[model samples]
Target: MSLETIIYIIFAGIIALLLALFQYFKKGKNRSKLDLFFSFLRFVTLFSVLLLIINPSFDQIELSIEKPSLVIAVDNSSSIKHLKQDDKTLGFVKSLKNNTELQEKFNVNIFTFGNQLREGDSIDFTDKQTNVHDAFKALSQIYKNTNAPTVLLTDGNQTFGNDYQFVTNSYKQPVYPIILGDTVSYTDLKIQQLNVNRYAYLKNEFPIETILVYNGSERVASTFVVYQGNQKVYSKPLNFSKQDNSKIIHFTLPANKVGVSAYRAEIKPIENEKNTINNIQNFAVEVINEKTNVAIVSDFPHPDLGALKKSIENNEQRSVSIVGVKEFVSKVNDFQLIILYQPNSKFKPVLENLKTLKKNYFTVIGTKTDLHFINNSNLGYRVDITNQKEDYQGVLNTNYSPFYIDDMGFESFPPLLSNYGGVQISQPIDVVLNKSVQNVTTNDPLLFTFEAEGRRQGVLLGENIWQWRAHSYLENQSFHEFDNFIGKFVQYLASNKKRSRLNIDFQSFYNGNSHVIIKAEVFDKNYVFDTREVLHITVKNKGSKTEKTFPLILKNNHYEVDLSGLEPAEYEFSLSTKNDKITKTGSFKILEYHVEQQFLNANAEKLQQLARNSSGTSYFINNANGIIKELLEDKRYVSVQKSSKNTIPLIDWKYLLGIIALSLSMEWFLRKYNGLI
Candidate 1:
């Protein structure tokens, strides 16, 4: 309230009081104590109402006490037990949590993490992977902008995820990392890496690249062997004279058998090597008798050729060859399916030969494509080209189904360049993707596939597929969406199988470290998704002859089962339905490989780097008691001071209305008692 406003309010109260006194006490009639009190109540209520009309606000200061948080983050991964330090690490964690001094100074929160972070003191050491960077990142997120000091404990041997040094430096806190495990390197012979294709054609030669690493022994003399089952296929002598050396071995093996075959590459373990689990590694490659050859016949080189080729080859059963117009005539007969890229003026002879062979083809309509010529040829569809070119994106057609790829809803992906006019289809076309122009979805087919008069054809009305693949990766952090789209198209064209109500698709082989997933799609007789039933699958371990049955769960318009924790062995699977009685059978092999055991020595350098980056100190696990004493003595990481202010309006106080009502009620009672109504 200002001085002028306060003076006006006081003068108004006096005038209102005089009016009330005059109205009630004129000629001093009925002038009793009760009348005087009634007069006083009327005067007070009128003055308070006049003040409320002014509506002033005032600031209120509030005090609060906030204790700074202290985060004790511990690594509870399987690597601790593998390094023979689980008992000591557990004891240290228990002691830190029960420390009275740390509890009194700040709110100490204990957390355990491996693949993800969790709050607790239970250290089970069962996590299969360790990610030190994730632990630091989790702490930073939970204690953001607070005066928090984090204590990290680990052997610093990160098996997965990015380097921890970056997160520790950016944590904005004092980090004290208690280094565990033996820092000294031990004598060991390890298979550092085994790289092989997951699938190969029957009777074709495939290559396996193996890198053998030796660290401790100066003279590493051993025999390297590659075998499948009990039969050894290849053997060589390995020798390293230096303390550290990486020997690369490449094996060209013939895929003789037609099934999932597991190959083991091993180095004969030395007598003094303490850790020999990493000496052997298993990898599998499925050899299939049926190989689908797909050729990309192009007039000129475009980046789309490379993108399409990579995605098509993701299926081991399919092989892609990029053939130019000059060489395509001789190579077209070798391919089961052909992808014609803008059949230009030079493709007249090629198109005639394609019709003679009666082979199915997928065509792309580009700027240079002769739409008029294509209209004459029977590729199932034609487009009218104009001088003006427009950019268009794909809008998925919900009803199209020769084979289905997962849907990508309108999410603002980059557009493909098309001629301004549009496409005109004269055949029975199953349009999979429509043209979405300027945020409006049109009925024009961007891509379609149809089988007409014993000829199967697929076509898309755009180019720049390289950009589509790159955009798919940016959208979902993987090239799976683009690859699935291409793979389904190729599969539909390469094989003319009778349609089934139930279908299952999975890899024939998988690395043991990766997640083993089997996907399924079920449709009713009307060809719509059948989502009202539970699909059961019986999984049997080939070696043990034991079986386990589980129901596949539906997600994202499909059914999938995650066989993650199954043993590293060959497994046979059978899926079944209830009333329909539909059954599907398949088998897959899981290769045995453990990446964590390759390292025999603790990574002390990374732990030391984290300490230096965060302005803290490092200590061995046995000498880690200094961490608590130093943290207590350091005053830099202490509680913070904070304050807040708020402004309150007088109208918000409902008790003021209660006071007015009470005053009016009292005035009424007093007047009635004094007979002055």
Candidate 2:
């Protein structure tokens, strides 16, 4: 406390005593010393209350010494267990745990990891997958603030994640990686990767590129075969010397059938080749014979017509035909979707045809658009145009959830040409993009959609979408973002789907190594999305007759469950909720694919490279004990001192309050007993 505060407290005490004397002291009667002492006690009690009203507090300092953390991370994947090095690894862990030198200096944290990270020596090396990036990420989070020195023990082969070398830079601690595999050489011929599109139109040809890598081959000759199911479609001879072992072979396959096409690429294993599992790779593509035709009807020529046409044709399964109003009036019935740009009196016949056909379509209302006719039409929206033109940018609405987008480049995209208009949206609709005028976000809808009379309808009250596409390409060096948005917009408008209260989204098939996720949306009686209901799913393997039930957890706008850990087989599932009695059933297939088994040998060189990148050295399992000696002698590793501050309030002392009450009671009882009154 300062001197000024002390002086104030003393002044309060004196004033309290003076007030007590005036209130209780007798002027004409002789008072005993005991009576005077009783008056003094009352004064003190009042003075204490006055002083404490100032609310005094104090700060207490606490000091602590934290030893450096030494993390020992072990690999717990099938590759390590296959090498039969579990005994050696366990012995090394035991030695580190019992080391006295490390115990005196550092706090040791041991962990095991494969597809995931866990604490302690509870690793049986049974984890089927290895994700080295996840292990590094987990360690970085756990020991980021400490003076951490990481010791990694693994063969460093990652099967289900990005390359570990790319993810190594995120962890800042010194990485002392131990190479845990033999340096033996074996002949290997493998299909490194296969690149092909996931969808192809029937009666069209698609290209496939295969990368083949081989070692220990001296003028090897092999036959590469491509099989479509059980039928062999392409066979070619591959002859190369050992020096030119890596080759990329390209093949054009025909899509003749309208179904799921599963193809296998295989190379016959040579003699003494160790990893035969990697010699073949299987992939499937969906082939569709039915193609949706889109018709673009415009009264006059516009740049947006060409841009929109090209965007829709990005997908080979869809084709766009641009025509004038007269041509579209004759052929509008042929296209599933019709796009009208600036529909005016000249296109009145086309609009009437659209209403008669009752098909899905969209209208782009610009300055030249006939606002009077659109307002009177049954397009599910009403717009009041003021004949004022403005330039507005497209801003993405994050809450829109009809489909998924990789990214929305709204910040850097250019503005679109729009008119000053008043718009209102109706039922069964949502805004996809909002408009921003002069960089200020507004509630005006740039793009909105609604389903009416079993037809999907969309409205874009703007123009010059070609400028947006050009801006995207200039900023991102690609037109993917703009093209994707426009393409999905047309695709959604063309879809003929009935509204359902319970809807589920999942793939028909998935590879065993891929993560299997199923998403569902539930709506209430009002037909609005509601996520408060409970949904349960029962999945049964077709072959084993075993079933399991899992409850869906509420995610951001829907319910979801991860079934990635399930076995590879065809399974049937049924979903039910407590709020609704209706049950939905579906089936999916898990392909028999094990990517980890293809990595027959361990990868030791990558571990050494990672250690060098992190300013540390690599060591073998036999020399892992040197870590303790190296850390103990290093000057950079030392105990860190930490200080903490705390505050305490004075009002919590209940004993002091009790003492004041006791003094007042004793004074009253003594005065009454002695008849001092």
Best by TM-score: 1
lDDT of each: 0.81, 0.80
Q: Per-residue CA lDDT of candidate 2, range 536-629, in tens?
A: 9899999899999998988766789999879977789999888877589998877666676676656878888888788877888767778778
What's the residue-level lDDT of 368 in candidate 1? 74
After superposition of all CA atoms, the RMSD between model 2 and the true structure is: 5.4
lDDT of 2 at 606: 85
Over the stretch 1-677, how does candidate 1's per-residue lDDT look in tens digits?
A: 57887787888789779977986788565566665667789987887787678766667888777777878888887778888888989898888889999888789888988777889888888766778877777788877788787778888878777788867556888788888887887777888877888778788999989988887647768999988889999999978756447888987999899887888888999878888889999887878888889989987889999999999988777889988877889777798999999887778888888788888889888887887788777565667867678898998876565665678653367899877887777767778888988889887988888886576788888888789889888877788878988898888877667667888878887776677888887877887777886798999999999999988998866788998778788889999876578999989888776665566757888888888988888888999999989988888867666678888877787887888889888888877876778
lDDT of 1: 0.81
TM-scores for all candidates: the values are 0.82, 0.79
> Candidate 2 local accuracy as lDDT?
0.80
Among these predictions, the greatest lDDT belongs to: 1
Distance from true location, Cα of 606 in model 1, Å: 2.1
lDDT for 329 (candidate 1): 91
Residue-pair clashes per candidate: 0, 0
